[model samples]
Target: MAVNNMAVQGKFITFEGSEGCGKSTQSKLLLEYLKAKGLDVQLIREPGGVAISEKIRSLLLDKANAVMNKECETLLYMAARAQLVEEVIIPRLTNGVILLCDRFLDSTLAYQGYGCGVPVEGIRSMGLFAAKGIQPDLTILLDLDVEEGLLRRGAERDRIELRSLDYHNRVRKGYLDMARKEPARMMVIDGSQAKDVIFTQMCARVEQLLS
Candidate 1:
């Protein structure tokens, strides 16, 4: 279909996982696939890229900001999300684009609420408010063992990555909990496999959904 002629039944799909789980790579692959199939697609990531949001992202990722409190970090994430939603996601969706987001509100819940031991209720409420009730049509959680993921990433650990192993464990558990809670909306994919295998499984899942 021509991009301008496409109806605005936009679908939001998110790729999520701990560091080094290939969320970025998979998101890019799916985005390319959709575009090749003649679907309108938009690619975006959280905490950065957009002007105000990029500033917040830097703060979130900068080790100099290490003194930032857990609640504050969560709030900053929500702030960036709110701006992202208003400036990027909502507009693209309204224009009939398939949104392929690298990460979404789920990351905040996994990292902040579970990993940092913040209250889940508060985090959920904040996320809902920030997103204006917009939830992804599908969330692909690339599941992997925390230790394996960390080891695979090697020396490429960033600020968020420098967090304790226990924190990552909690985040992984949090993602599993979310999958259990929202089985229809979330699919857990094994990330220990080869990239092509993972991509094949993802394509299968998307076909099932779009069929």
Candidate 2:
């Protein structure tokens, strides 16, 4: 599907936030909205877009792997991302698909760097290599309180989601910190708002980019 606007190049938009912050829902809504507008769009998630990445994602999220070390976890995430970028992301973007990602490099920075006590600089350095220099044109960060987000998850929690409140708080702070540093590229939105309200804000921002 070719886009009508020649001015609108392939845009990489990422959604970032802690668990249960509704990034997935918002990204999906954006994807549908763009498609309805006759835009060539694709929605994918981090650590599990392609076959290899999906395999890695299973390992990463399995509650059985509770004892996985922080360094190993970080490297595994990077490995999955590298595979995804080479196999799925680059080709889709080159073909002019408006790519909407549920999470991306920022997840590694927030999860491993802040939540797991890894060095932020180190994660960024490794992320650059993994992502092959592909940065999001716009990143929508859903800011939500740690406790509220956890409560929203209730019983079904993945390995990452089962982490302590302190860890989740660190992750949330890391996301906000990154947004502050890159205000132009990252839009911080309140996740506690109504779903329609959140989507409205997202659509408004994305329309600006498309226009």
Candidate 3:
């Protein structure tokens, strides 16, 4: 269960997308499939479920903290990520588990760097430091149009999702850009399709990776 040995056995795969794009749904389906196949899997979401990360998530998402600055918000996200990585992700993966993260570092880059207009370099630096060089083996990006995605959510906007339409558009563009830049490590999925169709394709992609 040492770090070096874990890195060799475990695989990290992350799902990323804007709100209402069904990343969560797909992630759940994938997790179930992996479990059924008898693979050791761990599911984690950002901003998060772990003790320390959950506290940071509360601060980041609380409507009452409306005055939090953009940079401060980004840093808070990094803090949560650092804790989640150190406490949960690293340990679980080290035990040879397949880590299926609902949202990972890409969310920070999309929401903070592109949507909020923070410099991409700064966000990347912070992410690198937070994750301590751990990178997903594959990143599945569920791509969708901002307007269509917003309509799907139907008035259930969280603090991040409540941003301007223009901001959401930029975030989507940012994800596409990242996929393009890291073609070997990322796959862009058509998220506008029906849920079953998306799930089927997701399974195929995962099967191919495992094969």
Give me the overall lDDT of model 2.
0.90
**Which of the numbered candidates is closest to the native, going by highest lDDT?**
2
List, residue by residue over 1-211, the lDDT tens digit for candidate 1. 1123433467889988888888988999898888999988888998765999999998899887778999899999999999998888877887777898999999999999899999989999999889877788899999999989889889876678999999999999999999999999999999999989999998998888787
Misplaced by over 4 Å in model 1 are 1-8
**TM-score for each prediction?**
0.94, 0.94, 0.94
Cα shift from native, residue 71, model 1 (Å): 0.9
Q: Write the per-residue lDDT of candidate 3 for residues 90-158, one digit (tens) a residue.
A: 877777789999999999999898889899999898888898778888888999999898998898667
Each prediction's Cα RMSD? 3.8, 3.8, 2.0
Instruction: List the global CA lDDT of all models.
Output: 0.88, 0.90, 0.87
- The segments of candidate 2 whose C-alpha lies over 4 angstroms from its true place after superposition are 1-9
lDDT of 2 by residue, 30-69 (tens): 8888899899999999889899999999999999998999
What lDDT does candidate 2 reach at residue 53?
A: 92
